[model samples]
Target: MPDSLPPPTPGEELIKRIAVRVREARKSRGLPRRVLSELSGVSPRYLAQLEAGEGNISVILLQRVAGALDLKIDALLAENMPLDRDAERMAQVFSKASPDIQQQVRALLFAHSQTELRAGRICLIGLRGAGKSTLGKLAGEVLGLPFIELNKEIEAALDMPIAEVLALYGQEGYRELEAEALERVSATHDRMILAAAGGIVAEKTTYVRLLQRFHTIWLHTSPAEYMQRVRAQGDERPMEGNPAAMTQLKTLLDTRTPLYERADSQVNTSNRPVKASLKDLLRIIEKRRFLDVLDG
Candidate 1:
């Protein structure tokens, strides 16, 4: 097995960390889970599930977790604590993330530093026609990081077109190829622009592993705009004989939205000019100070 494979029960560890923080906050506030739920407008059962680490929470629920404890949301999700003298400063940084994410981040830093690097890697994801390649290249140039398209790499690794590879090898084979491509990318340069495959986020283990290696940005596009762009790019087959193309596109977008939102930052790419969109994305990255966050 590869060294990068995330160990079993990662979700459980995350849940445990969340539960621990929730428990601590509840006690500190002198409130029971029911009372916390009432104040936060979250259900007691959900809150209990959250406290028990059995829930996969949304950003909103995470905020509610903080609110219920009178703690800031950031504090609840931060990956590390500061030193004794910097304890107060660290506490002000954000909520504590699960130990696993913290460890993952540390492992990433350690692994990456062993390689010497540049401006940190940035990952772009979302549906096709979201301008991940275009904007990712531009953003990478601006930030002085190398640009890499994972799909292109995957194709190169398989020595064939993606469609041909998929058709010949099947979905399972393609996933293995994808994993190998990702592993090769991860082992290479530490700082780069990653224009990732759109559906990578759908695979939990793969997504978490990649997250350990790159700061992710979700570039969102509306289905209408995506369809138009794909058509304009000469891939009109989706629109040709398939009357259900539009419906399927809409459903796919809806399904991926929540998953995409889990990204470090989100930029809606529909309608905006590419240049304008890249600038907005750059500002978002700077605002988040991902470089500093990653360094920590």
Candidate 2:
């Protein structure tokens, strides 16, 4: 509806425009097809067939279609003026099909489309408190698969808090633990939602390891929001005022954005509600048939 947009490509757009307009009007009227079918004494399946145009819909079908679509029979038959050639062709193809054939074609097309969009090697990476645990758990639940927090594996193996390990053994020690944990997970062939440390990608070996094994997604946010979300979760120590903290954060974000951009996908959580963000992430995963991608 915005004027700034370019005009849609001709033909296919026309079919979509008509189909979408009709669908929108039907939804706005809030008239369920079942009720319309009952009112017209037509079976639900017959009404669905007519609406979807998967059968030889006739003048008799028009009455039911009109009623279901909450339009006059005349309106149903009204000329879709200047029908786009492509839409017209598509309409003709659909109209010529038997109901069973239409269903088969629809199913095959749907399956093929799904195959193209499925996800590969999914791993969630972000700074501490960027919601790797929360979102990873949610993703796992929604995906009906195992959820793994890499830090948990590290801590379990080292018998210490992650910070303690970092402090006592230093960065190299932590990297070793991280590498080992990553190796264990990489060997397990399954649909797993991994919550990875933010800095892991800075380590060449670990970064390459993750990219090799999982489809990585960066869960990113504005520094201010990241601080707020993290503090709200009681990880307030990171926010201890240092005069250069903001500068450091800015540099980190600038540097990391490029690294994270290497991910299979990136999700910005700054403006979104957590629930909505989780749902969006899940939708992306599902759209890509992430599990199938992993297997491949």
Candidate 3:
């Protein structure tokens, strides 16, 4: 008889667990390996090896895979724990639930988690020309709170400009850094005003984390004004050799409206002066008492 195979080593066992989780997640989502490869920027052959437990992927590559799957990295790495099976089933169910139900669930869960995590933190989210940077700065000064631009934080961390970061790491890498920058900001500052990139909503995991950890306000404007303001800021890329840019912008706005509506509040800046919109923002914050911390 053939000699018994040597017992699996600890590292081998860990790799097996990762392989199983990756395969299970991909299959459950009905994502073809090639599609996942495109989303994760990992080669199909690499993904194949990973799923077969014959590849040990780097953390950065693994992060890209997890983001593509809309899963937290820790979820793929955690050792067996009580109720893990039930938790996985619940997560799948939640993913299939209606948006209204998902919102209800998020409220129930985040209410407890946000009591301290979100206290006195405010985040402005919207397209580039929505006045997040200007208004966030003004409001922070008025309220005696710090103001931070999330992209600037990311740039500082990487020691490069936004364009360079994208050129170097692609969208997935930039998003991974975005998520990390957000977490760092949340951990370091309890009371600050933050301006977030408009496309943050496209990433479900990061968007959910934003909602869970800050009082978010969606700032909006008309498509015309959005374009005008962006041009005023010296960013002509939208209109540079793109005759259909306006149409594309409108379509994008329409698509992201639902996602933006998920914010806790909204402030419209259409056809309004800067000072007037600032007043509206301040009034809403006061009326909503977004900064008030309740005692346990």
Per-model TM values vs. the true structure:
0.60, 0.57, 0.63
lDDT, candidates in the order shown: 0.76, 0.69, 0.89
Q: Who is ahead in lDDT, 2 or 3?
A: 3
lDDT for each residue of candidate 1 in 1-296, tens digit (9 for 90 to 100): 76796765866676677777777768765788778888898898998888777858888978976766656665556555322224444445423654444444446557755212223667899899898988988988888878899889988876889999989998877777777777777766666789988888887878876776677889988788989887888998878989999999899988888888888778988889998999999998788665553443
User: For model 3, what is the error of residue 200's alpha carbon versus the real structure, in angstroms, after optimal superposition?
Assistant: 0.4
Arranged by TM-score, best first = 3, 1, 2
The best-first sequence of candidates by lDDT reads 3, 1, 2
Q: Candidate 2 — which residues are off by over 4 angstroms?
A: 1-121, 293-296
> Please, what are the lDDT tens digits per residue for candidate 2 over residues 178-249?
987877765553457888988898898778757755777788888888777777888657658676766787
Q: Ten residues in a row with the worst lDDT in model 2?
A: 112-121
- Candidate 3 pairs with clashing backbones: none
Off by over 4 Å in 1: 1-119, 293-296
RMSD of each: 20.7, 17.7, 18.1
Cα error of candidate 2 at position 215, Å: 1.1
Winner on TM-score between 2 and 3 is 3
